[model samples]
Target: MATTSLVPSSADDPLAYRPIALVDLLDRVLGTGVVVTGDITISIADVDLVYLSLRALISSVGALTPPEPPGGAG
Candidate 1:
């Protein structure tokens, strides 16, 4: 069976994209991580989604670290 996209194709479609923060985006999803070369032809689109999600997770985790105070700064 052939399935057609529901998206109404238009020039504005490209402009409707979004850039979400790495941590806020990754919180809901579950996974480790994976990297690949650009030349690879497999599931390139989904890869971007995961990559962005991972970045957000890392960023959020980084912000959670406690900073040391002066003197001992522990």
Candidate 2:
């Protein structure tokens, strides 16, 4: 008795397809990927906290003066 082959040897077969690389897959996913559009709503609390933190950080950083010129005041 002889066993029969389940899959035929052919390049067109589904199993013969080449595997995709992770980098290529990610590139396609991250670049020119799907675009989803919808309405988004956020509570005032979240927005207020983010804005306040950014304002404080910006103001503090802006207050810092540059070091004195190498030639003593430009």
Query: Which number leads on lDDT?
Result: 2
lDDT of 2 by residue, 5-73 (tens): 765555557666466999886666555444444444545856633222121122222235555768896
Stretches of candidate 2 exceeding 4 Å from the true structure: 1-16, 35-74
Put down candidate 1 lDDT per residue, 1-74, tens digits, no spaces.
99977654556486554667887556533333333334323456566423222222323443556666778844
Q: List the lowest-lDDT window of 10 residues for candidate 2.
A: 51-60
Using all chains and alpha carbons, the TM-scores for the candidates as numbered come to 0.20, 0.24
lDDT of 2 at 54: 21
Q: Predicted candidate 1: what Cα RMSD to the true structure?
A: 13.6
Local accuracy by lDDT, each model = 0.49, 0.51
